[model samples]
Target chain A: MKFFSLLFFIIGIQFASMAQTPESPAIVFGPVFGDSKLQELTYYKINDIDSVQFTALKFYISGVELIHQYKTVWKEANSYHLVDAFQEQSLSLPLNVPTKLKYDRIKFNIGIDSTTSVSGAMGGDLDPTKGMYWAWQSGYINFKVEGKSNLCKTRNTEFQYHLGGYRFPYNNLQSIFMDMPASQLHVVLDLKKLITEMPLTQKHHIMSPGNEAMLMMERVINCLSIKK
Target chain B: MKYRIIIVILVCILLSAFHMATEQLFVAPENWPETTYDFSKNPLTLQKVELGRKLFYDPILSKNNSISCASCHSQYSAFTHVDHDLSHGIEDRIGTRNSPTLMNLAWHKSFMWDGAINHLDVQALGPISHPDEMGEKIENVVLKLQQSKKYPALFYKAFKDSLITGEHLLKSISQFMLTLVCSNTKYDSVMRKQTQFTTQERNGYMLFQKNCGSCHTEPLFTNLEFENNGLAVDPTLNDSGRMKVTGNKKDSLKFKVPTLRNIEFSYPYMHDGRFKRLSDVLKHYTSSVLQSPTLSAHLQTPVVLSSNEKVDLTAFLLTLSDKSFLFNPKYSFSK
Candidate 1:
């Protein structure tokens, strides 16, 4: 009877542990215009006349963390995700967090950090082959948004903003903190809000890292919000 | 007990394999400063260094595969293009500045005439992406290397992964460059009391210490600081050097101080290669130093060298050349 009870207890403990440990929680990014989901290279109606089409929309999301009651409960190891609007897979970021973990907020940086920027070439999403690193100088392009608009005066009516800088007096890295309600972890990046805030025609191209990049980077993070 | 014995033997085998993989490939010359490169991140190995050497000579890094790093930086000329005032690149394109000599680069804090590149690993990106130079993107280069028959195997042998990454590629190049130590010069011999300098050479050394030692410091032969050496600005090129990088007027006309080692073969000199001969460089220091607000503090007090003193200085400068370094078979192209 004692041996049988012990076996039953062990099996019960295994089942209990299995119940406690569920699947890994995931974070999904939803890039949308005013009312609809964003489609790459497709013209979106902004107003009565001007329509903008995004050829490329990409940004780096790094230093991911899960916060509970204002304390960090869990953090991703070497977390760096290059979120691309063109790629379907890149939007759904997989977090290696236990489903049992509790968190009220999700915190992350919108760009590459200063330390990683100076630390030579890296592989995976941080690789120079990803077309995100500057060739003439040493630094990563934190956020790249290239598109054409009928409103612009330049050739091809194109506007390109490649925002990144890790150095002082011009660091473009921005931190974001969003509340996680009901464990959904879905973040919405509204492109309409970003475009509406800035004067597109005048501030069309911002290629290098500077004060302009800092301003554009602010606009980038300002467009992100929790999809509750 | 048998299982335990087998485990012990397996552990021994594993330990030996690890030791062989990380065996020291670079030994720093005694008493030199600690290298700036973080070798822990990319440890040196025999396979990686050999792979880097092959890559250094290969023209596959260029756009049309017509130009290689060796085209502009020949080993015989101490790894710099000789007689070319400006760097000649692919399609006979002329670069804005002179191609700096490559020697004892392990000590360099930054690359390029203007100190634009912050680290050595990212230095190749400048030339590779420059329209006049290689005119190739790093993405295309990685793709080409992956598709190549020999590179994938070579990369696997070096990094233990057949998949070629930019990190592995750059780290391997750094391993080869770290081995280009030039400490076998005549001046080095004299310093070690292996030989004595001629009386004229000794006098020239004293003059050098007084006049030029501050900017071009000892041992490494460069302080590794950017300074405006007072070269008259070329009206046509109108290059502002370090100022363009920092966007500060205080840094205007400041260029990285070139190492005096291997100066005999590595010329024409200066950022623009304006001075063809060592004598012309000396003349510029003595009489032709263009005075500007950003001129190096050391050159503020004018250098006055007599004609005979110039000859002694030239003789002393030649002693800085290391035949062993210039002709090292290890640095040569291999199949």
Candidate 2:
């Protein structure tokens, strides 16, 4: 009888511990071309004129923060996520905030910061093996979008943009903020907006971070929005 | 019971011996600025430094397995390419800029001629992936290291894991490079008040202070800032130096100010290795400074050095050479 009672007590403690831990809310990001969901190799019209198709698209989102009112209530430490359009699981980020806490806004950086760029090699999303690192220049490519477009006059009608620069005068890292509700949050990236804004004829191929890269990076910021 | 206790003590001793053999502490020179390298990320270890030395001397980093880092950065020449104006790498492919000497890197905020590399740990990627240099992808290098009979075991000992990662590869190389500290020159001895310079050398030291002290600084012998030294752009290379990285017109032709330490063996000088001798370098400073929009303000005023003063300055520059650093067997190949 005594042994059975002891076993019951231990099991009760385990159940109580399990009940105390809460499930984290999921923050999902959906990529789309205006109203339509994005698919690889799908033809899309930009400004209803230029026919464009994307083969690859990958970018980094870092320094996620939860803002209540005007002040920052919570900020994720060492927050870096690589979002690949083809990878379904990469787009969603599960945050571990308390269920009772309320947040009015979400903030994040569109690219890796200067500290991580110079912090040598890293693993996970910041790993050099992720095809995001520029082996020739010793910096990570913040955003990479590769595809073919009829509007692009280059060979094979391809357009590639590998954007990265941590130094001053051409630093391409951008910050974003959006209003949030007390429920599951969804962030959307509209490809049509980016494609329409970019002047494909005058300049299309942007591999290095410069003034052109900064301009394109600005368009990337404008394309992101909170979806209801 | 007594035997078991004895065995346990013996095991403890063995474990401590192994720990001592593997771990090492990085000690900075007294009165020097704190190292820019964040040691918390990649801690120093004797085993990792040894592994880095082996990798530095190995040609497996190159695509063809023909050229090693030692090919360009030989110890005798103060870890710089000696004769070639520009660095020669795999297949005798000529590079655009001269290979700079590698020493006192822990204090450096950036690397390369144009400061393209922001960290010493990531600097190896530049040469390894350059078309005219090693021309090997980092992934392939890791794969090769994983397959190598000797490297896997070495990596296991250093990193406590058999798997070779790009992070470990870079951090290990950084550990070896960090050990390269050249502070025991004759000038250092004078600064410490252990020795006195000869009359000629002393005179040269005065002249150096009056003319070049602002840029060259002291101890490390570099201000660690980029400057436009007024060298005419090479027609073939057309290198814009720091301007290429920043895309700012103000940064045009502004190459990093190199350390004067070991400058004797580190010639030919300049970004493109345009000056072959110390005399040529002095001549450019005194007589051949080309006026440009981006030229350093320090060089705007003419450096009028008499022939005798030039000789004195040269003698003082020679005092900066640390023979101990050049011939230190610790930095040489393990075998």
Candidate 3:
């Protein structure tokens, strides 16, 4: 009987180890995609835009520090994940930390990591197979922006913004922080503000990180000032 | 008097709980150090372990329902791809790097050839939606798994819910992988004095410490740091290792220090699966280190290994092959 109990105890312990999950929090920091009018097509030329297509649009957001009552509770160590709203079906940012304690403010950066990009075949946010990560060319998509527009010529253009540079002054990982009450743990990004002032022509198909991806990502993230 | 009585009751309860927990938690192997992974956050359970095993064998974890983790990482091959230079994914798409063997992964602070993935639980998402790999989204994969006949019950058993979130999927896989402890190698036997290395293997062991021991350290067989072991860049692939992530040009040509355990079988070797044999790897190390700013200091001087020494080194690497693990029914595919 004692031997049987010992066997049962060993089995019980083994079962317990299997249930432990790492505390990586996944939060939806996505578009306020409700009742927004869809726009048209056009070429946004390289030097400001003649016409271009935007098939997908997304970029990195990192350096997120969560605060409660102006005191930081938790902040991501190295949080720069590509949040592509255009191509990806849903935007769920899973944070890697123990979230047993509640958080009020969730601050993060908006760009890809130089380390994450070079690392081969990452599993989560940095999965290279996503095409979000360039194949041996650069590294992480740093930022990915795509959408089709109607400026002229082609009806739709496939614009892919793959921004990332490990070579000297080309680093574009952006830091972004947010303040919010625990109850109002909502992050809303408006697409219209990111692309343009209003009537978006097919001139804003920006992909990859450069002046366009950098400027556009800055605008998109900045436009995301807390809805106080 | 009442306070003292309450304190005594609390002490008794706490003592009993602590005793049970100590028996429950793994007492580390004698003389072996602490594990990097903190198990207190998520306690192990039999139901969860069984659920994890089921998930490990299931293809529902992948995007296409065609390729699973087991597709690239086979148990027979030390949880590494057997023959491929580069790992092939769904639709026969080729990836940039070779799959590393998965054993004693709990000691690994980071994963992948460049040490990109810090945690183990969320590592599966890399393969699931990679365009050259699964090419499907996690949301869609979750939907598929949620709708599947096998997963709901498995998820419930693992997490007490069948909601089938990505978090649950990743965690289950981590659970299965963490259980893969490879401490029964011949090297381990020699350490325990159960068996001694043959003269050739013993010679090879000494040579290994002299040549490869710094990066492929003893006990766990890795220092867990990235290094440039001096492989000339493939003109076609042109991978710059850790430099791509840091954006610092200094880390160019650096790759994660791969474990030499089971090094006999888990080849075609290196990140891109360039070298087919251990001799070729040694030859490259001894003679062909490309001059780079990021070259590891250990490989600065040429390793003077005679042809006989190469044979001895190969013999030592072979001792790491734990046949029992390769054929372990506990880790193999099951329903």
Question: TM-score: which candidate is best?
Answer: 1
Worst-scoring 10-residue span by lDDT in model 1 chain B: B20-29
Model 2: colliding residue pairs? none
**Per-residue accuracy of model 1 over B130-164 as CA lDDT, tens digit each:** 99999999888888999999999999999989999
lDDT of 3 by residue, B98-196 (tens): 988998777787778876555665566667767777777766777888888878987887788977666566666776777777777898889999999
What would the TM-scores of all predictions be?
0.90, 0.88, 0.69
DockQ of every predicted complex: 0.64, 0.56, 0.06
Instruction: Please identify which of the two predictions, 2 or 3, would achieve the higher lDDT against the true structure.
Output: 2
Q: Per-candidate interface C-alpha RMSD?
A: 1.0, 1.3, 8.0
**In angstroms, what RMSD does candidate 3 have relative to the true structure?**
13.1
Off by over 4 Å in 2: A1-24, A34-36, A41-50, A136-138, A181-183, B1-26
Which residue segments of model 1 deviate by more than 4 Å? A1-24, A98-100, B1-24
lDDT (tens digit, per residue) of candidate 2 on B130-153: 889999888888999999999999
Ranking by DockQ: 1, 2, 3
Error of 2 at B306 (Å): 2.4
Error of 1 at A135 (Å): 1.1
